[model samples]
Target: MVAVTSSVPVTDPTLLDALRSDLRSADYTLDGVRSLLGPVAADALDREEALPARVVTASALASGADGRATLLRLFQLGEDVTRAALDAVLPTLRTAGAERLGLVATQGADDGDAVRAVVDLSPYAAVDAAGEVDWWIASDLGEVARRGALPENFVLGVGGASRTLAQITVREPRGSVLDVGTGCGIQALHASRHAGAVVATDIDARALAYARFNAALAGVRLDLREGSMLEPVLGETFDLVVSNPPFVITPRGEAGVGEFTYRDGGAVGDDVVRSLVTSVGSVLAPGGVAQLLGNWEHRRGEDWAERVGGWLTESGLDGWVVQREVQDPAQYAELWLRDGGITPDRDRARFEGAYAAWLADLDRRGVEGIGFGLVTLRRPALAGAAVSPWRRVEEITGTVAQPLGATIARVLDAVDLVRDLTSEALLGRRWQVAGDVTDERYFTPGEASPRVMLLRAGGGFARTVRTETGLAAFVGACDGELTGVQIVAALGTLLEVDAAALAAELEPQLRGLITDGLLLPAP
Candidate 1:
């Protein structure tokens, strides 16, 4: 790919308004794009394969596909078009207006001049904790459009990581939010929907420019700051802070390896993610919440939980870390190498060198594997409130419910509710099974009594737990009509056991059930 000097997108309010209006009028939205491409082409595009999309798009356009297809081919497919064709799609904005906004560049001085997109623009739709939303986002063109490695300062549009952070983020209405490492401002845009004010910060000027352009296009206001990590937000406290930071653990001082601003935080090993985990607590207001994605190195003889728990201990916040995936050093290296468009077939020697450098760096640091996961931290509402802070580290690699933001909020609430409740108090309250929970029983052949009983959750983390006979009976007895104490006492009577002993035995398990969301506190 030839090197091109990409300028920061222009930010003119009137031009942005006109562009938004044109897009809306032309029905250039996620649904519109999907309808134009259909399922197969869209699915192919999602996999980063453009041949099917190009074929379908070409066929559709040849058969008189409308304005949406033309815009899609121009902006998303990176196809240059005649001025008249672009004008037909963007009747309100036109070629001149788009050029003024820095969205496109004109190649020749004529009405039939070739116009090309300077940035990649696409429609992003999501169902966050706050229902559904649709917006147009602009960022640097990706490998699919450029047909090569991404530029170092390339701003990323909405992708898998963006959607993951969005879906997992707790989106309750808040006073303020900070979106650190906000490449193209996707998270900040989602924050703006629920937060009173949002501040988006990034170290890359080009990224900020794309973020500004995207916010303006979406008609959402943001305080765009230029700095690294938490530097821009120092001395500021926010009720909610969200980030999908550059937590990729890359080998430092490795020559010939491109350090993309969107993935590399200029730190060796996993220091970048560690620093954020330890220091982000300073910017969180009392009772504030911060959710971020990170990669942690699992060194020799240390469990993944222990390593991540150490970071939480240093941060002094209530932390819950979920390890979603782990990759060996070699696999991790190859994954990122291919991501940068460097493949064994294209550049075998270069690929081998980069791979060897990555493995050597991991070996030097005694890193066995890289663990990627989501980290959620909350500042205790008041000093000394979490003297023994709530910390949970687990792995859930299986499928979970979509829009986990709501589930996360519920977990936080449940944690807080059960943290201070005494065993006596917990048993005194009425309890009921959650709607998404079910009981499963396994029996030995020709046996009346089940050999094993399990409780499974159908949503959220999709958790499963083995239950004892007494606990299983107790859960079956809960119907929101009786208090836990009544059910336990009745069970104890039927089993010829002491009521107090049974209550004592089941108290901790009951608390676990509550915290895991299999059981709910009845009103």
Candidate 2:
């Protein structure tokens, strides 16, 4: 384990209160910063380019700008400001309070009495399924500010992965929720809005310290603990479990490979994610759901679905795995290398060495490509049920709706409903096409009838399904006015086929449409 220092922010109530007041009074918020930096600079900052933002902030400071610019320069852009300027901006929690909180440090009389931020503090705002939130997050300064590789125990603030997990998480109200590997408490903070109680656990003590401070700053309560995955919550169950675990596959025993606490689990070849998928069910309450983001390897002569499905098979829970992206081994290596700040332009030899190590390690294991995606698992509500555990593993590499929590909840319900029903019972229910669904028909040049048909959804996963004439007619006739049996019988008569055979042929497709949100059960 890596040794963590005490340089993280402290949770002092009085100082925090004062800091909050000053921030609010100065309008140090997302909109405020955006207005100050304008669209170009703000967009540049989003791309991790700091020069435009630095130019804007430096100009603002030279012309005696407001507190927002000062804070942006000092805390966000890693620029130093005089103690007098900082005190003026943070009148309530002055330089002394900031120093006490470990947010900044003074350069003494030799460096012109300047102060620099030791940590990164910035505004965060989001309007998720749970509603809108505007808060400040504090974490380790990133490579953009440090101009070098991140420390092994670096605690990350809101990044692309954090936002991705937050957007995909199912956010229905629950009694208890657990956020595993809660780096800087971003997901836990979002969970607090819908859950009655939240317990966030991490193996890194430095991460816990940052999470604690963030919870205090946001005025949210989280039962924070220090332990590896599932250890802190042993023997306890939660209504929901969410994790953005350290699933990155870094080469072990490689000379230049970095062991980052935030990304690497110190395990070999996607085991961190596999272990979580197979074991998270032990902590889920009956009918509870666990949503996670992970990466799985696609090795030679092995199908990715079968490999990931094997994990689900061992979990004893209904599961859905969506592979959103795939990268070849070489592409995967370069991505993580640049992510760790070892760019070819900066350190050619080190970058080449690390890249070689990554390829060698992956090749040794017969790995060809890597699959990244979302995983959702559910414990059956009725124990010892006769129905087989349901599993859906697929690849969807395209645009989809944001805040997919509601769609996910609905899909789970649909799956459960269809799983328990017999073929005849399912046929007895009336169904209708979702409003977002539409069909396209293609005909041979001058043919009187259409030859090919397709069904596309505008929402949810934006799935498109190809159909034959019989299935297309079935979907077109679905208006919640006729049962499945009635529609199939009518189509059978018109197509000169047996109703029983047509029903059997279309039953699986209907169930698939329902689970994918293309069709819905009538009220």
Candidate 3:
């Protein structure tokens, strides 16, 4: 096999045009990337055995869709299979379209690789400085086989986590937002939409350059700071912070990077994320929120939730940690090793050792599993003291994404526990829950020692009232048009219970329901 290279001849006008059209269409399909020029076919991207081929086929997903949607869907192609696909396609495109590829490099002046794609196509240049990350997206719906073959060396592009971050990020105009690792700068660019200014920082100068160039091309303003994590933003607090730092528990090199700069953080696994969280509190302004994607080891005696929960207990912040996915040690080992291209035929002992280390790391720590999800922190009021560590929400991603910015503003404005929110006014309506009462009613009678039953058939916050009769029938009478006194008086007559006692019980229970968000206080 010989390396194949093509130089674009100006005389071949039609071929260039066709290539351009393919790129243009792909770019559109992929979100604003313009085009994807491969030096060879995609199939042989890493085929040192096959690289020299004069011509082969290659595919670039193209860069032309809205960055968030395009990249999300493309990278969503799972980890393993996506890699194999890029390997197969890029080499072919590179060799056959060498002429066009040269033009791409020379024209864009970005020939130096760092991993380039039309958003959905790829993120970090698949080619790394050493060009040794052996990520190969597989063929077949292999390895859950999502994502196409990616440049083995370069970091890969956006995925579901990135999209979730993009979606939940409060879309308010702010002074600046820092995308800590700035892998592909997706967060930085996304922040630019609502933020007055955006800065993307990364220790990888190569990544910084790609971020700057990509931002410029897309007409998004950015301050590309080349420095490690939050250090560059020292002394300067941001209105918001977002990061998709490298949290692959597996170390690079031995594990082989799924894409070098992208996934491999350092030998200290997950150090990038820990650093980001511990220090992120300082850079966040009062009311500022740092949204981060991370993976925490499930330590033996220590809980995965507790590890992450601890990260959020900064001096001045209220935090929420949602643990979405967990993978046991064994399952985790095989999954990532596969990403590193650890074939039995290649190196057995080394791969086996890597797996052993991973398992040992987990076992030593008493980690039952690995947990992944979002961590959000808001700067706390200076006067407040104790910060706590806790595991609260299970549906972390969905819950965060559910909050409308305006609604969140309301939550922040409350400035008090939700239960205390007695009166409610919204969108031109007034709501109050007074007559609602609760009763610990019983079913199947004697089988129950006792049961507290609650029912709120109607009324704002669905006015809940408990009944010892299993349904003291107090809630059945909340007509917004009438006052609590009137409804209670009527229920007293109907249910034959002391209406005043029922309404009193109802008040506390209904308030609790409103506080819990089981019901939205009607406006």
Candidate 4:
């Protein structure tokens, strides 16, 4: 195992307060950083390239840019800066105070000594159900800054997956919430907004420390625990649980050569995700929900749904899984290898060995491709109730709604509302077409009426559904002015078809439309 030096700062209350003040005074927010770096440099920095940022910052400094530029160059780029520059940028924390917080280290004894950021601190902003929020997030430096493979226990900052999880998580108010593997506490911070209490756990001590520090910086309280998977929350039921766990499938060899605690769960071949799916429900309160992001192995002749659905079956919870993308073994290995900062062109031999080993492991297991996506699990309100569990596993590659939390909440509630309602009962209630739903028709040019009809949602998975003429007419008639049966009977009368036949065909479609937000239950 390669040893890594720890550079994360201690979370001292006094120092944190001073740092926060200094950060705010320097306008070190996301908008502030973007304004300082300009669009090109910011976009380049976002792609893990530092040259554009370096050039921009150098030009800004030469042109007499303010404190924010200096702070961004030092902390964000992991570059060394003069002590006087840092002192100017952080007058409240000063040089001595920053050292005490373990945020920076001075190289020489003189005032001209170079100071370097001990951790990567960046400005993050997101708009959720509760409105806009801007925060300063701190984590271990990335491979771009370190210029090497990540350490085994490195805690990652907010990335695409993290943001995806946050955006999809239902933000309803709850009594208690759990965030498993809460590296840097991003999920936990979001949870704290609506949840009465939040618990965040991680197997790595370093990760827990980072979480603690981040929670403090964000002014959110989190119950920090040190354990793996469900160990920390044993026997503790929660209203909601969310995780962006270590679900990455890494080939384990002698002494766990390439295992990372943040991504690898110390398990082989997607078992970690399977285990979490099966076991996480044990801590869910009745009518509770758990959301997670994971990857599952797709083997020859094996359907991805069956592999993931089986885990949900064992848990006895209603499961909804969406496979957003799939990658073959080579693509998967290359993506992760580059994520770990290993370049095939530069380190050909090492990359080849690791790549060959990963593919060989997949070959041994008969795996063809890997499917990555989201999972949402719900515990039934009543264990022995007549309501049958709903299991939906499918693929969705199109763009989904932002703040999908609202869509998820609507779907879950709609399922409960109509779960026990028979076709006769379903038709008795009035329905309305969602404002975001639109109807489109396609036909060969010059044809009179449309040959195919499509019902599309502008948000929430942006799903598009093909409908026959009868179903399309029924949906168009839903204006919250009449009952579903009234629309179906009226459509049947107009189309010269049996009313019951039309209702039977349209009832199932109604359920799907409602769940996908194309059809809304009347007020």
Model 1 spans > 4 angstroms off = 1-4
**Backbone clashes counted, model 2:** 0
In the predicted model 1, the residue pairs found to clash are none
lDDT of 2 by residue, 96-156 (tens): 8998998988876342488888889999999877679999999998878777877777888
Each model's number of backbone clashes?
A: 0, 0, 88, 0
Residues 1-523 of candidate 1 have per-residue lDDT tens digits of 2233477679899888888888888888999888988999998888888888788778877898477877887788877778888887888888899989888888865767788888888888988767788899888877777877777777788888889999999989999999999999999999999999999999999899889888888888999999999999899999999999998888887875668789999998899988999999999999999999999999998887988899999999999999999999989998888787777787788788888988998999899999999999999887665357889999989998878898898988998899889887898889899999999999999999999999999999999999997899899988998998899989998888999999989998998899989999887
lDDT of 3: 0.50
lDDT of each: 0.88, 0.90, 0.50, 0.87
What TM-score does candidate 4 reach?
0.97
Using TM-score as the measure, name the better of candidate 3 and candidate 4.
4
Candidate 2 vs candidate 3: the lDDT winner is: 2
Q: Estimate each model's TM-score.
A: 0.97, 0.96, 0.60, 0.97
Highest lDDT: give the candidate number. Answer: 2
Per-residue lDDT for 247-270 in model 4, tens only? 988888733236777898978899
For model 2, the local distance difference test gives 0.90
Error of 2 at 292 (Å): 0.9
